[model samples]
Target: MAISFNQAFAGHDKMLEFRSERASVLANNIANADTPNYKARDISFDSMFNNEQSKLRLASDNDRHIQGNSTMGESSGLLYRNPSQPSLDGNTVDMQREQAEYAQNSMQFDTSFMFLDRKISGLKKALTGN
Candidate 1:
């Protein structure tokens, strides 16, 4: 029987990737905060997760067939944030809001990292009989 790491790690690996991508987007927004007409972009987790969930239907030609492994889909695209107050220069990046979002995203990324770490640790222990 072949075991796929995708099945073992579940969605943690994909979640980490998504989080990293979001961090980059957020950092870019912060970097261009002063640039005129720079629109702040972000990922919507609901959109990605919903896309993943939609692919999880069970279908089998035989009763003994194994179920398909469902993995999280890649991000469709970045979503633009509507500014609370439009700047005269047309820059949409809000430093305070961007900073808060960055911090929150960092925490979520850390959480996914910790979850994957614990899963790997547990698997190692199981294999080593520790």
Candidate 2:
């Protein structure tokens, strides 16, 4: 029987991708902090995860059928932010908040990376019998 990696990884890979995209969105907001009328955008994890999960899941015709695998499609979960302290320039990017979020997201990405790495290593050991 072929080893199905999707079950082994258990969505860490997907979470990693989501975190990376979120980082990009947050960085973009930071980059546009000075742009007039630029609305800061962010992605909701819940909505994005649901979107990806629905796409990744496949219908099982038989009780014991191998699942389908495919590239994860992009999601449109980006939403404009409502500023706590509105700026006169109509820019919604809050420097402090954006920085905080970016840092948090980086940490989460690192965590997911570590988990996936450990899982891969464990699988390798099992296969190698060493």
Question: Largest lDDT belongs to which candidate?
Answer: 2
Task: Give the poorly placed runs of model 1, Cα more than 4 Å off.
Answer: 50-75
lDDT of 1 at 8: 81
lDDT of each: 0.87, 0.89
TM-scores for every predicted model: 0.78, 0.82
Model 1 lowest lDDT segment of ten: 69-78
Name every residue pair that clashes in candidate 1: none
Clash count, predicted structure 2: 0
Give the worst 10-residue stretch by lDDT in candidate 2: 68-77
Q: In order, what is each prediction's RMSD in angstroms?
A: 5.6, 5.8
Global lDDT for candidate 2?
A: 0.89
Off by over 4 Å in 2: 53-75
Per-residue C-alpha lDDT of model 2 across residues 62-97, encoded as one tens digit per residue: 978988765554557787888999999999899999
